[model samples]
Target: MKRNPRKVRWTKAFRKAAGKEMTIDSTIDFEKRRNVPVRYDRDLVQTTIKAMKRVGEIKARRERAFFKNRMAVSRETQRAHRRKIIEGVKAGVKLHEPMSVESPVSSKVQEKIKVTAKRHTALLPGEGRSMGMDID
Candidate 1:
């Protein structure tokens, strides 16, 4: 069985059609096959190699920029969708009472209180030393 190149997801045609690849870039033009025969010169070959490297770099940069732009748009849409869901949830939910204020004792104060209570209990006569050693 034969498969259409345009329909295959991995094919260049499909990627170009789907706007997932650079279709009309100048670097892309450099990649086309030329049937014309040229006399091989050492200088020409070296220049061609340099040009190819430069073109590859330009193409890669352009592709990265394109991908970043596409992902940015997707990220924005995802953020908007998440915000919409949160808003919907907020609208449907009702609190029975007003939200409570923070405790009179701050977190640091609570932690210090707990530590002091533990120290006091540990120092008590009946209770044995933790880990066979006094923790003072």
Candidate 2:
């Protein structure tokens, strides 16, 4: 079956078109194929290898930054959607007003309740003899 490269999800063309890949980066330009043939020198080969590694690192860093920025925007949109849902839920429910402590009914309720402090007794010097033995 014939498929359009730009529309195919797994194609490089699609990724570039969808802004999922870096299209205008200097590191990307370094990876382009050259038609001209060059004489192979040991120093040139070593320098080219180092340059390739550096370019790969730069590309990876830029890709990470791009992904982070994309995810940040996605997170903000998700937060806004959640806030809207919460607001809708709040609108559907009826909230009761808080009761005041100084109200007549509240004062009567408080008067009906009793609060007591508990006291603990400490052992005297003579009571210390039973500390080590268990009694039935």
Candidate 3:
């Protein structure tokens, strides 16, 4: 079967994804959600370009290397390696694992706090409980 790749215009701008990640999003009720932004770090990519040039190409070890040099690029030119590996795919190099609105939680921490009203209860095992917890 003949194959034709989808063409997309490239620019130095953040393009939002047409759809949301099904894994990261799951709707139970009839509520609706907006699409998550597909962010790309144009600046970071520029930084990586600078870093790569500065480091130069690293010498691939001589010992029986895993999966035989797929790109067969010289240790003198690094971009040559990436060019051979990634062909035609635009916007190369993934920028981090993406962002999320949720905060990271520790597994050992409790989710909710239980408040009990006591007139003479001890607070810190000996500090004597306060009258009430002012959440203000």
Assess each prediction's global lDDT (C-alpha) against the native: 0.87, 0.86, 0.45
What are the models' TM-scores?
A: 0.66, 0.66, 0.15
Candidate 1 structure quality by residue, lDDT tens digits, 8-51: 99999999999999788889888889999899999999999999
> Which stretches in model 2 have alpha-carbon errors above 4 Å?
95-136
Taking the tens digit of each residue's C-alpha lDDT, what string does model 3 give over 1-136? 6332222323212111311112222221223453886467999879868755543432123212422443344443677667867764545665577687665886688688788876774544424655556445
Candidate 1, residue 16: how far the Cα is off, in Å: 0.7
**Worst lDDT window (10 residues) for model 2?**
124-133
lDDT (C-alpha) at residue 92 in model 3: 69
**Which predicted model would earn the best lDDT?**
1
RMSD of 3: 30.2
Backbone steric clashes in candidate 3, count: 1
